[model samples]
Target: MTATVHTLQANRAPSLEPMMALTTSGMNAVNAVILDRMQSKVALIPELAGHLIAGGGKRMRPMLTLASAALFDYPGTRHHKLAAAVEFIHTATLLHDDVVDGSGLRRGRRTANIIWGNPSSVLVGDFLFSRAFELMVEDGSLKVLKILSSASAIIAEGEVDQLTAQRRIDTDEDHYLQIIAAKTAALFAAACRIAPVVAEAGEEAEDALDTYGRNLGIAFQLVDDAIDYSSDSATMGKGVGDDFRDGKMTLPVILAYARGTDGDRDFWRSAISGDRVADEDLARAIDLVRSTGALADTLERARIYARRAVDSLGSFPAGKAKSAMIEAAEFAVARAY
Candidate 1:
């Protein structure tokens, strides 16, 4: 059998602009709700929330919720509030994550935690989480509340699991996957699944969308991990090797540690466990990851999940929304950052 070689450089997936265009109107509503609900007499609440919200993320999660609902031609406006709620859930997580990670930058700007304080960031995250629930209640659907609430709980558990696994070289691929699925993919699944519920699209459609989101979420995180070791700060928004310095047991590190020689393993352990790592150490770490083929393998794994995400949409009818969704999955793995 002929051998096949894969490279991240060769993957040119379509942009997400088309999907955003498809849901532009719905997204407008979502944004409006986000702005409206973020307001408070407290003043600082909106300032802190708006700082992160305006900081130039793609808002991919809420877009997915809106697009999935559009896939079913959902006429109800409840999805607008639901999509805002999804964004609040996502933003809240980011705020809390920065505090947990002691991150200085996000989207190429200082993290909220750094600007305000850890206490402010955590409390604002709590506020957003509570606001998300309020929107869910306004939607008047117990099912929506159940799905998002479950996702929130799973995300917290995943964060704890990752905290425990941090700097532990023994952390395996399965454990890493479990962490990402819970911390990240759970929300993606809920965001997509909720759309069909609001549309009354029945169980089959709901299941299909759920599968799509779950797989896409996994692919997205895989690429994110790979980029942490491969890209520059300008391209990646956050600092390159942030994961390495933080001792995150992401897939690339896991694979490299598992496949490396004894000396290589020692280097990984020392580099990751150190209180502070120099630029040279990060460079050496990236070289080790590249030489072990871990980066390529991680991207290849992400490609598999992206394919699965697209395949999950097979049961849906052909249309603009469906095509955009398929492209969205492809974009998940193929994005540069």
Candidate 2:
């Protein structure tokens, strides 16, 4: 097996296509459920939710649900609805996050909050949460319910924790890691773990998948943080300096600030304190992250987590399912390029 941490040379990076191909039929089913469940008599509910749903977001979490079931060669369609539920939970978070962050762009388009206003965006997010729970209850598995519901709660707590830590120059890497594990990785873990439950593949399998998802989720977020400084909006699908402008204390910022000169530290403090948000300041911030090796180090850290994610699958049988999942982890870190 190829180690998941090799530097992704140009044109040799991993692709999500294999995973997408692996889960095609299942994803089609999941998509139908997503489209069907997002509907409501209230025109705005679907309208607002549909804006983000149709916004070219890669349904990665739900696809993980489908892919993990494939790992067991489970031949049931029950995962379709559950996968849809996972996506609903994810979409709900994105909606609420945009509102909370006052974000203007997502996936290269205006956010729902920007288009429809925060109140509608928030209420629609609440509606999606209701739909996610309804799907879970309809699944009729207490174990699945507990896993997803707990993840949802943890995600909420993580968001609150992030809100509290937002823009604080004193926020450390360990605290940042805890926040991402809950806010981001919790759903990823629940999405994969539920596969074994519906397949009745036992607790050991569940634990393995949980670890895979959690680590992959961390890698994914770390890459996103690095991309904010290194990639353009065309690549990132949002403003290149959005995190900087928002005063987000992502790993790249944390590391750069930690490794900065006295002058650089003062600049970071002012930048993160919202005192220096002009485009030139953003250019300087990007330079500091790169000059301090924070960007490269953050990506290396992502590769570390991605490797763990791939290793967690060692217990599973080897085949396209396992290979695709492994490549998915590679793709998570490779996206930075």
| Tens digit of per-residue lDDT, candidate 2, span 145-168 | 999999999999999999999889
Candidate 2 overall Cα lDDT vs. reference? 0.92
Compute each candidate's TM-score over C-alphas. 0.95, 0.96
Clashes of each: 0, 0
TM-score of 1: 0.95
Candidate 2 error regions (>4 Å): 1-11
Q: Model 1, stretches more than 4 Å misplaced?
A: 1-13
- Candidate 2 lDDT for residue 162: 94
Clashes in predicted model 2: 0
**lDDT for position 91 in model 2:** 93
Residue pairs in steric clash, candidate 2? none
Minimal lDDT window, size 10, model 2: 1-10
Q: What is the C-alpha lDDT of each candidate?
A: 0.90, 0.92
